[model samples]
Target: MEAATRMSGYRRHFSDADNEFEEENEAEEEYLDDPGNSSTSIDHVSSGAVINSITSKSSQSKKQSSIQQNSNQTLIKEALLRGQKLATNSREHARLTKSVTYWLAKDSQPEYAIEKPGFKRMLKAFAPRYELPGRNYFSRTAIPTLFSETYDKLKRTFSSTEVSFFSATTDLWTSCAKDPFLSYTVHYITPEWQLRSACLCTHYIVEDHTGENLKESLLEILDEWGLDAEKQVAITTDSGSNIKLACRLLRWTRLSCFGHNLDLAISKGLRDYSIEEVLQVCRQVIAKFSQSWKKTRDLAKSQAENDLPAHKLKTDCTTRWGSTYDMIARISEQQRSICVVLATD
Candidate 1:
């Protein structure tokens, strides 16, 4: 009974609205037709005004009602679309947060989670309503929880008897700030014979670079991860005295990194007097031009005049043989430009 009363009230409200609209149109026609408004009648006629004379009042009423109905329909559609957008955004907010956290973790971009310029712009375009997680929030909370969950998953993956044995590689390097870090990478074959490699961990080495210190760190990491040292196949590392001694102390089969050995061999072979002189000259030429903006620009102009693509000379890394080879190769390619720039100077 209450619903029927509400339905009648809605019908009465719409009926009153339609009647008021029709009354306004009738009054406008009457005002235009009045002799007092004769001056405006010419303006109405210029606009091809019907003035409700050609069509009867009922017909005019029906046309106005149709327009009002169309407008109401449009308003309803807009409201529904707005509602759907709000609902979708609410549902997607959680998922987007999780995905962003995971992406930052996987790419080792914890700093990106902080509100930087490009990062904020990206979020504004994709999810304007979402708030970006802070760097501290990710580092202090999100990353640790994510690590715990991932640790459990990896433990389940490696618990199978089929994955009994695994190989690991360790590298210890000093950062630009002179802080030491150690990285561990694990390699294993799945049951389907697919080879997979994963970096298990990278952590700061607060202790000194001694064999005993490294051995203790490795043992602690393995024990934490529940990795069986007896099931380890071999450990590969660069020919660092400390690492070699550590592996020997652990009684694990140690292999010198093949790539490191190859780099050393190439470095030794390139130590001839003639080769050294040529490389020294190339390095000097590159270093002089790189230090001066005018020289670099002049070299670029020379390359353009000679119809050659402008390219920068690579700086050699004394520790890396590959970088030295690349530096020489790039210098040789841009030899004509460098000579022209030097000749002008």
Candidate 2:
């Protein structure tokens, strides 16, 4: 009977557990049947999915934008490099070359100056990528072309109708190499009333500079320039016998240069004994200072001490009275300093 009672107790325990489980299941079913609870669960799931999709798309878009920006920057850099390279080949190169040619011609620099290392370095500092041509190119091509263009332009201006009449001046001089050269220059008034002047020619005279030879040379120069003898108003020249005779031979109006007359008068006046001796002493002093560096340095120190201008002593040229005047003027200006320096010596 004890064994049968135990078995019945076990069955009762199981029956109570089953009742609890059934109660839990019924509660869950009631909660699910509510419309508000069901909609809230579905909305929460849909919102989570939408937020994830938007975040993923935004990440992809940012990555694409970064890549596109990098590509655009690369294209710009490449384009800039191409533009710089193109500058060396096109109008910019030509302009730079022309400017260089003009500078060289104006300054009378040798053609090989362009090939110098220092010049190349300086130019490279200004334009790194530009290629410089050889000196031969300038000598053969650029210089000749510039000369031709300038000549043609001048010729056109001189031959224009606006230039009705012109006066000329002629001079003869021997170069340092003992070669005789005769130069002719013309002056005119433009239509705008502006004074204009141009050097027509400087001819090397192999023959003697006689009156007849000079006249022939002048005529040839005028013919070459298309200048009519009738249009010439006058020719001015120094009072040299040969040149004066040449003016008479041409049979055109001739005028003596006032500057030449003034120079002659000054030269004659300076020949007085007292003035000549003083000029000789001044010249000797200048020569001494020029020959000795120590004297020059002493002169500079004396000039500073006396609060005088630091001007060098000028040597006069015998042919030009203006140079004599300049020499005398400079000596007078530095007289105290010179005395101090000589006293110290």
Candidate 3:
């Protein structure tokens, strides 16, 4: 391409002067030997090749500059669009609209005049604000652009660190109506040794929650953040077969729920094998209490007299895991009394 651009000028220069051929080659050779030659030598040159080369360089430079300008403009436009989507509500839309407006104002064409009342009205109308006046703009906002900028800066800062570690916790549970859900939490630490939110979150939403579906979601999360599962340091989850398999695939350190472990061990070791059987009975007893309004009311009276924890009539699997742990602790501690009550029935 350089040679082609320089060809036209070479043709033009040689057409202008048919002579000075040897001296032109000598001058070109001298310039090659020592690049310190001033523009005076180029001006004196009568060679078409030399003039064409200079013109080619200028043309290439202009083309490069134009390409760079277009790239930057495209990047800003995409950033504005993607960043606005991350805003959660109408208030967020207004704030982001103002930001885009500010960038547009950089064009500074006579299209928007500051002195005009109409322009002032438009600016006032568009500039989204809050009572505190900057929370929307300044709070812990997550924008794709911010992520790009932060990742770039951190890339420079931590490129030398070889052993970056990341971890994730995941679990599966049946929701109300027996629909299943798989949840994952990502955890990572910065090169500075401070904890940072993982680049992944929530569920990867699929048609149905199955083992194959779970494997796909897990792989998708890692792929999105450019994470290698082999690099994961730890994973925490319940003792579900699918979860155990996924962790094994990643070859990470696995941790079972210690509370579940304790329950299993206690049930296995207790002298009164009746405790396990009693729990099965209590499960039905709890259902009886929860079956209708009347039973719930009677249980409430008993709770009131004994100053016991309130009994929620509704049956839901939605309580946090800690709630189950607490219930187990309570039943284990009150086993003697609970056993007597169940036996009398």
Count of steric clashes across candidates, in order: 0, 0, 1
Candidate 2 wrongly placed segments (more than 4 Å): 1-89
Cα lDDT of model 2 by residue, 1-345, tens digit:
998999999899999899999999998788789987998878888999999999999999999999999999999997676556436558878888898999899898999899889999998777665678788999999999998898888789878897899999999998889899999999999989999998877899999889999999999999888898999999999999988888899898999999989999999899999999999999999998999999999999999999999999998997765999999999999999989888876
Which TM-score value belongs to model 3? Answer: 0.40
Please give the ranking of all candidate structures by lDDT, highest first, separated by commas.
2, 1, 3
Regions of candidate 3 where Cα sits further than 4 Å from its true position? 1-163, 174-181, 203-216, 247-260, 263-273, 298-345
Q: How does each model score on TM-score?
A: 0.73, 0.75, 0.40
RMSD of 1: 13.9
Q: Give model 1's TM-score versus the native structure.
A: 0.73
> What TM-score does structure 2 among the candidates reach?
0.75
Highest TM-score model number: 2
Candidate 3, residues 119-232: lDDT per residue as tens digits? Answer: 556745654232212323432342344556656754443334533766778877665676666676667776667876533445635456555667787887677556667777
Order the candidates by TM-score, highest first.
Answer: 2, 1, 3
